[model samples]
Target: MPIQKVTRDEILQKALGVFKRQGYHRTTMDDLARACGLLKGSFYYYFDSKETLMKEVLWWVNRTSEQRIFSVAYQHELPPDERLGLFLDRLYAAVLVSEGGCIMGNTVLETAMITDEFKEPMLVFFTNWTNAVAHIYETAYPTAQALKLAQQLAAEIEGSLLLVKLGSPESLLRDCRERAINRLNVPMHDCTSNP
Candidate 1:
């Protein structure tokens, strides 16, 4: 018999969905394996343990955000407001906001206190996100104020995502997007505009 070859990327893609939907503690190796279309034993060929796989997943999430989400913040060709809008749009699409809540947010809430391994990656992910928003806010306000507003935007978005999960309304994300743009005094425009 031949051992099946699975790329790390393939495993992470499927594992991310499982973790996002089922969370860390509740998700088993079998669950991740099944998500990857591998048997439990075969899963070990790719990862030593769930924690190792999860750490890789977090790294994968961070890399994806850097490439797709955070990169929008650095688009100097776009106006700050447009950059911010595009950033939110990319974030919504990347997280598949309609299907499952933010994976990083869910993972942090589920594992922040219990797992030391997740701490640094979570912090790095959030700090980068905050800085990206803050850079946009800085265009209109002082540095300290910009950072404060950025932090507020981050919190509001996370809370809005929670609201979405609570059956409040799908429009909650749009409302948050509007509030963020309004709070920053950015001209009202379609956040869904392509970057």
Candidate 2:
């Protein structure tokens, strides 16, 4: 039989799903290899260890979210509501509503206290998220108030993700998005976008 080939990006993406669902401590190289459709031993050809794969996964997730979701806040050409609303929509679609729910958040909860390997990328992801959120809130309030509101938004959305992991309805996230938009005093009818 011919050997199966996979790209590093593919391996990282697959590893992310497993890590998100099972966490860093619970996941094994075997689990990653299976997810990537490679043999257990094949992982060494790509990643030196599960820790290496996880660090790569964290960076991959951060890069992807930064480009797709968080960067929307920094796009100054867009209106405040559109930028924030689109950011929330893309955030829900990419992370919150997913089966495992926010790889960065889940990984931090599992590995942050035990190991420092994952801390840098994890902090980068959350800090970027908080900064992006604070950027949107800055449009309405003073700098300090905006930062506080951003923290509040992060807390609310993160808590709602916990509900999603518990088999709660997606409406909880929807409500969070709506509240986020409504806080900007955007009309309720304007929130037609949900992904």
Local distance difference test scores for all models? 0.83, 0.82
Residue-level lDDT tens digits of model 2 in 1-195: 234798999888888888878888889888888888888877799999888888888899899999999999999999888999999999888884445898887877787788888899988988899899879877766666667767788889888898878988889988888887666663334323331
Q: Which 10 residues in a row give candidate 1 its minimum summed lDDT?
A: 186-195
Across 12-103, the per-residue lDDT of candidate 1 in tens digits comes to 98898898888889999989888787889999988999999999998899999999999898898998878988999899887764456798
Q: Give the TM-score of candidate 1.
A: 0.90
Would you list the clashing residue pairs of candidate 1? none
- Taking all chains together, each candidate's TM-score versus the true structure is 0.90, 0.90
| Candidate 2 minimal-lDDT segment of 10 residues | 186-195
For lDDT, the strongest prediction is 1
Q: Which residue ranges in model 1 land beyond 4 Å of their true spot?
A: 1-4, 186-195
